[model samples]
Target: MKLLGIDLGSREVKVVVMENQEVSQQFKVSTMSFYRDYCNFTGKIVVDLKKLGVEDADIKISTGYGKNNTDLEEFETINELKAHVYGVFYQTELKNFVLLDVGGQDVKVVRVEKGLITDLELNEKCAASCGRYLENMAEVLEVPLTELAEYSQDPVELNSTCAVFSESELIGQIAEGAKLERLCAGVNYSMYKRLDPLLTKFKGKRLVISGGVAQNKAIRDYLKQDYEEVISLAEPQFNGAIGCCYYGQLTGEAENRE
Candidate 1:
């Protein structure tokens, strides 16, 4: 069976095609471009699958930021947490693990025990510990987002509880002639600090990091100190979509057996 999964995030739209529970193809595009060019915003967002080069999919599922409003017919919608957990399990061999998904506008910490989510936490009130904060900081530092994770080796001291104030603090560090690498490390550390509190209540030996920020090496390195093993998905950004595909496959197989 061929399945199409779509994860419409605040910043990007991730799509994946799976054949017999294995990934066949995947693509990602900035949400702004997707909205402006491909989507028709008539009450609900609609995309032409053929225009997007996806056709004749046996099953279609959507999740993430705008899943509720996606105008795709004969589609199933799953919650982000379920999608993320399934994505992690499908991609890795680890059955017991914690899932950390830091998206453009929110962060989710999920504890998986015996292949099911037992506990979870979410920070939707602020973007401080999310990917958007890191993007803003990288812009202030005049560095590429891809390079920001590599710039931090030894993070200096930065104590800003708010994302808005952290920018000012970063400016002060720059004026103090702090090494760029150290400042970048400070940024990465600050994000980790924000995440640590939310994850403290959960106890999982392994961690599966997903989302755009999972691509950051510094964040992954810091996460390793706390987790027995820190695993990053092959396509961190596509985890949600992949999870949807997994869900589709599971149900499709069940129906066939029935």
Candidate 2:
């Protein structure tokens, strides 16, 4: 059976297709383009599967920030936490771990024990601890995001608590003749510092990181100091969508057995 999963994220839409419980295809589209070109708003935004190029599926599932706002015809909706947890389970096959999914505008830290969520923490009130902060800092530094993520040593201190003010502070550091690498490292380190408090409450040796920020090497390096193992998903950004597919497969199998 073919399973389809879509994650309507804040910045991008992640689509994943699975056959016989294994990933077959995965892709992403910008959130703006997805909404403007492939969706029609009639009280809720209706999605076009043909335009999305994944028209064949036995089951369809969706989860993310925009799941509630989008009308996915015949598609079942699941909460972000459940989707992410399932994604982590599918990707890492680890039953116990700490999951950290930092998205464009928010952060989620979930504690999973024996394949079930025990506790979770969310930081939606600030962009300072999210992916947007790194994007903005990269722009200010006139460097690629990948390049900015390479620095993890001797980071300059960025003392701003707000995302907007942090940009101003980063500019000030640049003017002060600080090394380019240090500035970039500072941005990554600061984000980790912000995340540290939220993670302090959760005790786990292994941390499974997903979402867009999972690609940031500097941030991952920083996290290594705290955890015994930090696992990065092969398809970090596509995790939620993959989780949906996994859920579909699980439900399908259960129904068949019943």
Best by TM-score: 2
Candidate lDDT (C-alpha), each? 0.87, 0.90
Q: What value does the lDDT take at residue 62 in candidate 2?
A: 90
Q: What tens-digit string does per-residue lDDT give for candidate 2 at 8-38?
A: 8889989999997789889999998988999
Residue 210, candidate 1: Cα error in Å is 0.4
| Best-performing candidate as measured by lDDT | 2
User: In candidate 1, how many Å is residue 39 off?
Assistant: 2.5
Mark the 10 consecutive residues where model 1 has the least summed lDDT. Answer: 66-75
The pairs that clash in candidate 2 are none
